[model samples]
Target chain A: MIMKNDIILAGVGGQGILSIAAIIGTAAVSRGLYVKQSEVHGMSQRGGDVQSHLRLSSRPIASDLIPTGAADMIISVEPLEALRYLPWLKKEGWIITNTKPFVNIPNYPPLEEVLATIASKPHHVMIDADEIATEIGSARSANMVILGASTICLDLPFEELEQAIRSVFGKKGEEIVHTNLSALRAGRDFALQHKNQA
Target chain B: MQKMILLGDEAIAQGAIDAGLSGIYAYPGTPSTEITEYIIASKEAKNNGIVANWTANEKTAVETALGMSYAGKRAMACMKHVGLNVAADPFINSAVTGINGGLIVVSADDPSMHSSQNEQDSRFYGKFALLPILEPSNQQEAYDMVHYGFDLSEKYQIPVLFRITTRLAHSRSGIERKAKRAQNEMTLPGDLKQFVLLPAIARRRYKGLLGLQPQLENESENSGWNQYTDGPDKSLGIIAAGLAYNYLLENFPEGNIPYPVLKIGQYPLPRLWVEKIANECETLLVLEEGMPVIEEMLKGYLGNCLNIKGRLDGTLPRDGELNPNLVAVALGGKMIRGEEVPSLVVPRPPSLCAGCPHTDSYLALNEAMKVYGKGRVFSDIGCYTLAALPPLEAINSCVDMGASITMAKGAADAGLVPAVAVIGDSTFTHSGITGLLDAVISKSPITILILDNSTTGMTGGQPSAATGRIAEICKGIGVEEEHIRILKPLRKNHDENVKIIAEELAYPGVSVVIPTRECVQTLNRRMREKFKNKKTE
Candidate 1:
């Protein structure tokens, strides 16, 4: 059977979710899969909530936007943003999200309450992506960490994703690429460890 | 054919390039800016000697493109839906003047007001101007339609309106490129007086335009972009227009929508297909991305005719962009209800970036205007418009692009002392300059605060026409050189900036205060580029 994955990547503006989408989209295209991505741009980029609907399919994709409650995965760079897109997630959708709260508003919900809301999801993996990236010597690679956690749900070959990170960040230099790869591995390891424990 | 992934805007730009376009003119606006940007970025377009440049506003852009068309070269003008209002005069008149070279005016509509002030549909403009419109359903169609639009425009001797909504404008899909044609040589219209719109000539030209309606409609009927696909069920007929077709097709991934579908991309209504579907199906569902133009047309003025169900009949929403989920429900599919977002997730509205020059400028303006009080300051559109929000509710009015200076002048004329106008540098050039000229001529007691950030900060920092020429333009507009004060908008210079603003506010004549600073975003981008270059060195 041909593989099809409808993913919603969510985050605040400047959270580097577009980079994540680009990396995954490049990977999907390289594997000869049909890819369509719809992104939020313009005024919303000023720290507002943003989400990109990315669809990868072996069959031809009709729409750039994924249908609500049909998305296979919700990968978010921020905890609150992950919950914002619950309406678009399928019943069996996996929520791979970073544990950080990008507190820009005055009345942000308590962190524990936000975590509890995400925890309510049937399949979810929460990780301190920023901490993991920092530990891996690249604090800015938190987006890659979140992407790494999503690999558990994504059906694409892991090696393709690793290669995507290299190509997408190749312009940044060899050091940054190495650091981001390590961050991705750390996030994957954490998810695997938690899943094994459960 | 080489296929490349492109946004709908980029696809249109690429299509125009391949269609032998000689020039593209535009003013940067969301969802539409990328069209011209793509043309400017293309090495092929550059080598082809295409004239792609930002105009003062949509009006100048359209007029310039019209001039290029008069020279017998394919040209395009693009802007947001609201920008159409600014270019409406030239656009409407172009239909009457007709064309020598092919002309396509692209109006990227924002149905949900994504980054726009209003969700006005541009299809109405096309109909109002009595011009054929091409509304593509997908990125590939967006590409292919540009070539068709230019051909239709040339064949009919009328400018064609190409309309797209925000969803299609921003979405990305793989598009197969066509063989590129060479650019047209400079060739003038056969009649020297063709563009001259004297009353008698205009009447004749208007008649000529009115006479072309049949041909335009005939073209739309045979346009291939418009299709009538038969289905098994006759219970419901779907009239899907533009990007709404994608949403409709998305509901039935198997490509087996039971209802007969008439997918419309070209305008003149395609009456033949419409009549066919109306005769075939019992009930009609009109799915359009923008306002219910087609739905209302199908329903007619009376309450009667076919059982038409759409935005007006409440089958779908009256406003906002349509998505697949909404279409699914309309198609009688089960509503896929997912978990509701927690109320704890507060709204995170867009704000000025940290270290934005507008923040410091607003702070200083607020302090300076504290004595005279709030509500006296009028602001224009840009990132600076965000100052109307909390922490710095410095500006009172944000009516339009250049309303700040004019509104402030009117307020001052009505005896409001120290009436201030806060406008960005790019906006100042866009339309604010004319208002300033009005203020200067009347000697209106207004402190026009032109925030010279050296870029159009709101729409992704496109190079502004007023970069180094603001002070010169002010002086040329007859503002006193002594009263034109420029200050650095920064935390450290806050006190000095406030003092300068206060001095301008106290001036009884037209005084200009310019808080000069580079936009933080642009500054960071420059620094990053510089750092990259240094590393390479």
Candidate 2:
């Protein structure tokens, strides 16, 4: 049996990708799994690309960074981010990502072409998480939606994940707490319902 | 139990509040700025009677906190490790004078040189002062230790030093906070002679400190913070300190590393703990962060009996932070490969934020000083200190807070033509005033340029104490009214600022030039708040 699970999250700036990764990392820890989370928030505030490494294990974790192609799962909040981190995903590992494009510089692959290429792979699931986030409330919470949708495949306790979401936003205020929790559940429901269709 | 999320620095501030701190004096520096800021922003602190304010610099902060302790009220002083270097005089002397009420001096250190000038460990300061030092592993212990620290201080009647590095100071952790304790009532010293630090009394106090050495050693020996645990193998032992202990415990394979572990927290190197570990094991690995202080202390105590290994022999890094993998590798465990970070170009050094007011001040200073000659600009630490960096290498010297005025005075007294001291308003008040007084009384012919960007900019824009008083202070300090000039610092008004600076530099008498500008970061933040408020309305 595998002793640990490694997940990679990548995105462009101004997306709520960090929040999504934090929630997953927190949820893993709450479920009694040893978790190590690290991020290069960097000059991301300056509109740079952002990536977070989240590793969960039954045993103790050491480093914050993960080794190449060691990720059991790669979840990208942005389309190009998914492609950018493609090499880090383990052979035959699952890639779950939003189809939204966030191009900082000019001339990247067209959104459809990028998605088509990723879908041609044996292990990929694409969703318009931004639309899902907007329907729920704010498009910023799309990252939370991505985490919520990816939960089914995460093989962790849903109740504990809910607890983690509540824990992070619970102190902010009631409205924010409810909206994020709703976003999380919506993402989860969407992923679970579409697993067979995909 | 009330569960709350707190920043590590905020937890320390809350810890001080919970521990019944009557007063806290601090000079703002990154990683340690929040401790003073949280206290100032707290309604509870104001209502429950805690006096929290930014002193001019670390020296004044230390001196003021010591004065509060003299009145027999619980007090805490806070500063970054470099600030400790500035406050070292009072700090070393405080150990000799001892304390009346409980006292805890917090030195928030920045390891890896994050937002700091140097990574000098505060544990060395603790050892130098021969005072008890406490290093908390995480935020929870940071809070608990603050409370425990005061009690320990009062029990020992010696001020305790609480050291937290950048990682522990910035990391978020859940802390279960308790109700605030009642404040200690003001009490006069029973023996007034003890409070008076005249030479005779100081000598007596120095003797008292010396006599208390054995008791301090005993306290370290029996501290609840230190513990020992048996491991799978008696052949090897682990000596982990502070956060290193947490990392060691986390990486212990099978919850059983082939070593007995001695977790040391209380300092002066618990001889008992070291002896027990050394006697029992053939090989011992020392685990600690930031410095080799503990390993050095152990070498003297444990000798070469145990094959002691740590930062000294590259068992671990002497600088930067420790993670579980480093501890794991030190314990002869399997090497855990980490993600290779994409190689990027060398990072650009931090410069002044775009449109910062200090930019205009530097522009003016750079232009004004060129006529006199190169290397005439004397500056001090503040946001204005960034003027020393590239593109605007305008400042000649920046020793510490208030050193600009004094240093300029020294140069002028030595007959250096057209010397000028450039300092921020917050820095002027912090250590600049006394130096100004020195110039005024001595009639030193130095053109003191008080850069009034009405906030402490470098440490994230805390309120500059001389908001509306810089001009008044210059007047009150006996600066000739004719020489006290205020010019708006703006690129549009750049000509006027430079003209004023030039006029003052040529003046034979002592002069004060006030270049006034609001901190751009503060203005931007306020404008956003105003927009948000208007939308709400």
Candidate 3:
């Protein structure tokens, strides 16, 4: 069977959601699957909510936007942003998100309420990705961690995503690439552990 | 052949380059900015000696592209939908003037106001100008249409309007490449009076354009981009245009759209195929991304015999962008109900950067204008316009580009002493200079605050045309040299900036206060590049 994954990557501006989309999109293309990724730019980049629709399939894709309630997964770099796109998620859709909050706006809800709302989802894996990335020696690789957690929902191979990370981050040098790879593995390990326990 | 992933905008740019484009003129706006940026970054474009640069605004850009076409070289002018409003005069006249070489005007419409002021469609503009329009259904089609658009422009001797919306313009997909073609050599029109739009010449040119309508329609029918695909079910015939066609196909991923479909990529209404579908199906559903131009045309002003369904008949939402789910619902598919978002998740509006110079400028202005009270300030479009939001409601009105100066002048004339105008450096160069000249001529009692951030901050830090020349331009515009004040907009210089603004406001004549600083985003980018270079060394 040909694999198809419709993922929505959500975050505030400057959270590197486009980077995640680029990494996964490049990996999907290398696997000879057709990929369509829709991004938000311009005025929305000034600390506003942003999301990218990423679709990968064996057959040719049609629309650049993924239909409402058809997304297989939503990988968010912020806790509140993860909940913001719940309307796009399937009933069984997995929401793998970072637990850290991007508190750019005033009147931000309590951290516990945001966490509880995300936990209420039928299928969700919340990880302290920033902490894990910091532990992995690259504070900026938190997005890589979220991408790793999403690998469980994606149809592509883990090794392919690893290679994609190298291809995308290769210019930054081998150390940065290795750190991001480690962060990805740590996230995958956390999600796998949670899934096994469930 | 190698394939590369490209945004819809980039695909169009690459298509133009491969189609032997000699130059591309554009103003930096969302979704459309990347088109010119791609050409500017391409080594191939450099090797081919293509002229790609940001113009002051869309009007000058279109005229520049028209001039290139007059010289018998293929050129392109791109802008967002509202930008078309700025370039409407030259754009409409370019069709009457026709072309010596191919010219494609790419207007990327923002259907949902993603980053724009309005969601106006560009197809109406195409029809109004009596020019051919090509709306691509996908990135590959966006790539291929440039070649066809240029050919049609050359053959018809008219500029082609290439329309796209936010989704397609910002989206990315893989596109295949074609062999490159050579740019046209410099040659003029055979007739010396071709571009002369005097009354007598214009009448003959208008007649010539009218005569070409049939050929344009025939080309549209046979364009192969517009197709009539028959299906087993004949209950409903779908007319899907541009990105709307993609949404329709997405609903039927099995490649089995039961209804007969007329996929329309080229315009002039392609009557024959449309007639075929209308004759076959019981009902007609027009799926267009923007307005109901096709639906209204097919249904006429009165209701037609066929059950015409679309934005008009309430089959789809009357406004906003059409997504696959909405198309699915229109096609009688089940509406999937998902989890609702908690009300606690408030809206996150876009704001200025933390250390934005606009904040300091506004702070000083508020302090200086305390005695005068609120609602005396007018602003223009730029990052500084964000001051209208909370924490600093510094600006009162934002009408359009260059309107700040003129509006402030009018207000100051109407007994509002010391009326202030806050405009950006790029916006000043774009349209504010003329208004300043008017202020100088009338000696309007307005204090113009030119926010000189050394770049266009709102549109992601494109280089400003007013850089290093604001003072000279102000002086040349006849603002008194003594009253032309420049101050650094920073917290450290807040009191000094406020004193200067107060002094300018106290003056009865036209005065300009320029708060000069580099945009923090661009400064950071430069710093990072410098650090990278040092590391490399």
Candidate 4:
């Protein structure tokens, strides 16, 4: 079996982008699949852009960068960043992006314009992740929300994803653990409800 | 026991704790910070009376660990790749002054310049010091290596370096940990002459280090971590090192590869496997991260028939960290899509955190130097260096720690008016103090702004070395008390601080202005702790 999917997740630092990619990668690997991941963050503490690439398959991943037009999916936590990586998405590939942009990036594309561009694509999910997160009790967790939304297109089982999340962040604290688990469930539910609407 | 999830760094710390480490001393740097933090916060570690604390800098950290080792205890000194340069003077000399107990130097290298100035390979340092180096391919190896590293250090009577790169240090994997080992009995150094590095004794210890090299290499050849794989096909052999070998195995669909594989984790190349793979295969690909040091060495040993290929042959990019895709390309397989990378806009450079004291200090410095314009102020490394970017381009030069003070002095001596140096509290402690002493002795007409944020600030605000005593140290170092000025750096205090800065800059002789404030991050942490304490109280 050939390993074919390359997934890139990009957002400003402090968005929990790394954790999201890590969870999905872990879930895939736990199922006896091969996975490779690379992360790039410049001064992560200062809130700069952070990008992580996850390549998944039954075989070993080859490249660190999700080459242009080769990304099976690009899960972005911010709208502008999703547009930033738009050129990398395959013609029919899926993009799951949150509507609210991180306030830090000096100049960002307007939310609607970004939504319109993503809508132009064949397969896309534009989520008001912050709104969903705020309803779920924390806007800081839009990352998991987007991750959950993207799972609609990925081939992994929901149980596997949940197990990875529990294993990864369960040590953080019970309250935080419950809230984020709720957020992930909310995201997956949202995606399942509106996946084909666009 | 249940499989507990652990970061590679945490696993190393767990392994150290399991190995009954006496202490962990380190200067916080990315990829290495979590190791020290893990030890400090671990309940099991603290309950076992293990000591873990942030050292002033990498040099002091290593020296303190050496001191612990000399007292017949296992000690770990952790530092990032460049921090090793700061600690190299002691590191190289430590080989000559052998230890009484186990000493493990944890060097976490950033192969892609990830949060670092350079991508230097520290494995070379191990070879240069004639020290046995154990590299782990995954988190389990990282943890297990620490325990094994201590045993090896004790067995060989030499310090061992546990080398990890960004990937191994940051990645998370399932790690099966062993039961805790009993602590080594504390005993003082037997021979005073052995600990002292006087020329006579140093020469003898140097000979001892050299004598142990052969045995170390032989042990490496036989190490379980170093494996020789035999498969059905032998057309093209692969010599994969560290995590690259793990990445390579993913490419083969079946458990067996089409060629013989020499997966190396121990340093000082396993010659037998090299000879075996080289003699059988027509072409060999050397896969490793960072530099082509191993490839260079392999080429010399293998005849022309081996046809060695790696970074040196442009099969791999000579720079940046490697991933499996890069290794697959070296193996002559299809590159990861072989598609062109989409263009990305040049990223906006990193800036100081919002409400950071460095931001306020930079603003005040800019306001004070509105007349001097852009090119007058010099700065050094630390959080304040971020002021060189947009919104507050106050600093002019930053070349390593302590360069600001000395470089500004040189410019002033060469006739630049109102020359200034701005260094963070942590950077000053790292190297700026001696430069300040130089300014005082020379009486250079330079204004040095010691931006005291009371934390390192850049690498997540581990306690600043000069947190409690920059002022006293400055006075003790011979700067005139009258020439030293201190001001609280805050938005409300900005005007007063700027005025104080102006007055100090106008002074004829060497002047020191310390704009003081606790880092906002630290302040928040303190606030949280205060709230927690109130509840407990």
TM-score of each model, in listed order:
0.98, 0.79, 0.98, 0.90
Cα error, candidate 4, residue A183 (Å): 3.5
Q: Taking the tens digit of each residue's C-alpha lDDT, what string does model 4 give over B281-331? A: 877888887777788887765546458888877988889877656666776
CAPRI accuracy category, model 2: incorrect
Worst 10 residues of 1 chain B by lDDT: B332-341
What interface RMSD do all candidates show, one decimal each? 0.9, 6.7, 0.9, 4.8
Share of reference contacts found in each model: 0.78, 0.03, 0.83, 0.15
Ranking by DockQ: 3, 1, 4, 2
For candidate 1, give the DockQ: 0.81
In model 1, the Cα lDDT at residue A10 comes to 95
Error of 3 at B67 (Å): 0.9
Q: Chain A TM-score per model, please list them.
A: 0.97, 0.91, 0.96, 0.91
RMSD (CA, Å), each prediction: 1.5, 5.8, 1.4, 3.5
Q: Rate the local accuracy (lDDT) of all candidates.
A: 0.91, 0.78, 0.92, 0.80
Clashing pairs in 2: A66-B339, B56-B430
Stretches off by above 4 angstroms in model 2 are: A1-198, B178-180, B301-306, B333-339, B344-348, B367-378, B387-398, B406-421, B437-448, B478-484, B502-512, B531-537
Worst 10 residues of 3 chain B by lDDT: B297-306
What shift in Å separates residue B287 of candidate 1 from its native position after superposition?
0.2
Docking class of 1: high
Q: What lDDT score is found at residue B31 in candidate 3?
A: 69
